[model samples]
Target: VRDVSEGEACPTESGFIADQDRETIVKSSMLPHDSAPRVTSPAADEGSMQHNISELTALCTSLQRKYSELQAKFQAQEEEIVKLKDRVKVLEDREGVAAKQSRDDAPIKGGVSMQGRQLLKESVMTQRRLQGF
Candidate 1:
């Protein structure tokens, strides 16, 4: 590449210089006028990049907070599930006790066979009917 200050001809790949570059010279033929490419300062580019980084950091922090909230909610739900299971176990134990008590309270003489218990029940029922109760 030829420097503009050197005044040396800029080399063209096809050996024929395009007229677009020649038309850009205003007062000094060595410098381009309106057609010069706009240059952005390094500081401005750095500031933009820093802004993007700050936005990303804020987004990451927000996501982390949401994740923590969800994790806490999930833990609470699990604890609730455990508590419900314990309650169910207690209810099942109470039901089992009530069922066992009912069985023990059933009308039947001790040491009686199943057939003797049935005959005793029928006799009692017949006596009840005769007494009109």
Candidate 2:
């Protein structure tokens, strides 16, 4: 392993530098002459990866909790809809029963009966005729 100087190109064991390696070399060469290339140890890289993993895990947990809350709310709304539907059904049944009862008691109600309605109509016609229409 000979010491490679600045501006000198070195071939790897594969006899070619990869595009990423070439890019890194170009970037390092573009820095100021007084500044050395920054290097990180393998341990530092591992620590950074661990930190990212922990943050991702926390974000995933938060999203899961939010999803669970939304799902519960949806279920509660569905239950409320079912209860409202049942109430509407009960009201419709009561209205049907009331309508049937009203029909059955029509004659007993007197003024609402067909005969009473005809008499009222005749009385109105008589009054209108007396008043010259």
Candidate 3:
């Protein structure tokens, strides 16, 4: 290898190499305009967000009240149904008792003690005694 000279440029096997002092600088340019980008007011935006949240909260509250009312109505209807079922059971029991009483009394019709029949016999005896007198 020969000693490099300061006045001469160095040549590589793949041709001349790029100089370190000379570099290709990358730069970009933007268009200048009068108006700037849009900017929203913080106060107005916060007020709108608050109003929307309040509306949603009111809707939720109303829905909660409606749900409570519907649940109460359902419970009342269930209680009413239970009461009606109990009444029906009582009525059926009364009908069974009446049926049993009638069945038991059916065979004792001739052996019945009737006050009207006793009074009729007493009246006939009194009439016979009066006719004999």
- Per-model TM values vs. the true structure: 0.52, 0.53, 0.49
lDDT of 2 by residue, 1-133 (tens): 5457765657666545477688899999988795678899999999999999999999999999999999999999999999999999999999999999878757655538666787889999999999998
User: Candidate 1 lDDT, tens digit per residue, 18-119?
Assistant: 555455544367665687788889999999999999999999999999999999999999999999999999999999999997676664567565677889
Tell me the tens digit of each residue's lDDT in model 3 across 1-133.
4457755546674443343223322122243454888777999999999999999999999999999999999999999999999999999999999999866765555755455567778999999999994
Clashing pairs in 3: none
The lDDT for every candidate, in the order shown, is 0.84, 0.88, 0.78
Poorest 10 consecutive residues by lDDT, candidate 2: 8-17
Q: Once model 3 is optimally superposed onto the true structure by TM-score, how far is the C-alpha of residue 42 displaced, in angstroms?
A: 3.9
Pick the winner on TM-score between candidates 1 and 2: 2
Best by TM-score: 2
Q: In model 3, state the lDDT of residue 112.
A: 51
As a TM-score, model 1 comes out at 0.52
What residue runs in model 1 are displaced by over 4 Å at the alpha carbon?
A: 1-39, 107-133
Residue 66 alpha-carbon offset, candidate 1, angstroms: 1.2
